[model samples]
Target: MPAMSRSTEAIVRIDSAAKTVFAYLDDHRHLGAHMSASSWMMLGSKMDYEFDAGEARLVGSKFGFHGKILGIAMAAEQVVAIRTSPRLKVWETIGAPNLWVIGRYRMGFEIVPETRWSRLRVFIEYDLPKAAPARWLGLIFANAYARWCTGRMAKDAARYFETAGGQAVPSIG
Candidate 1:
């Protein structure tokens, strides 16, 4: 059996500059503050960078996922040549010793510049396991969860920017 792939996307218009939005998105510590409660819960605790490289060299920066049921982790990189704007791609890695055997997961955020506000488009792709029970269950729930999380993250990001005067607040916990 072959691996199954699933993807979902969400877009939100934020009342902030594209560079500001991109800066906020680039910081791993501020991720939870801009993510919905459920999304944060699913993503687990605040992420800590495993590599000392700065945001400019995000391609190799690894962050701990820290989820309860799923010990998934993520690596940051650039998106495939799609748009000219700044895009950040975060994909799951199965290098953790105690992590669950979930399939490949990738999430991309494309920040498009606008006149006064910026458009943040988020995309999530999941490659489900090929096995029996996990496949069926993932097909039924993972897709929906991913979509929900994507949308919620976009919305929360907008709200965060709006409330914080277009600045990213430091992550709590």
Candidate 2:
């Protein structure tokens, strides 16, 4: 986040309350669902997660994703920078990231109240990877990855609430 020069954002109107949506997404264990699973966006690569102490449920907490991509190891550590209850949550990558495409980033989600539902905005401000190969590839795929990552988060939340049917959101450890 120190010098993130590019960003991508996606907004979706969810059929759930501001509080409801915030509560759901605030538990970021459920966020980044797309990256934890193999998909076209990830080119069939799946990353494993590790959340430390209280599962990164509050500011100053840490979490990460580590996995091999095309026979090379890649990883990143992220720390929650801000968490305003039932409204906004932001996290940023720490140290150098050994990954492809988008590298270090500040990612966040915000919920806005409406009469009956909520408007959710998911965004990422990022810098391309510093490694030459990854930076070169990033110039081609960074925006696409950002768009897909944000869009997927929004879509995932929407689907979650719809199928949840007002039941309580579950905890993931």
Which candidate number would show the highest lDDT if scored against the true structure?
2
For model 1, residues 39-127, the per-residue Cα lDDT tens digits are 44355533333424443235554444332334545332222222233555454443322322335556668887888888999877667
**Model 2 agreement with the true structure over 48-103: per-residue lDDT tens digits:** 98989756678999998899877789899999999987888999999988888988
Candidate 2 — what's its lDDT? 0.86
Every candidate's CA RMSD: 5.5, 1.3
- Candidate 2 backbone collisions, by pair: none
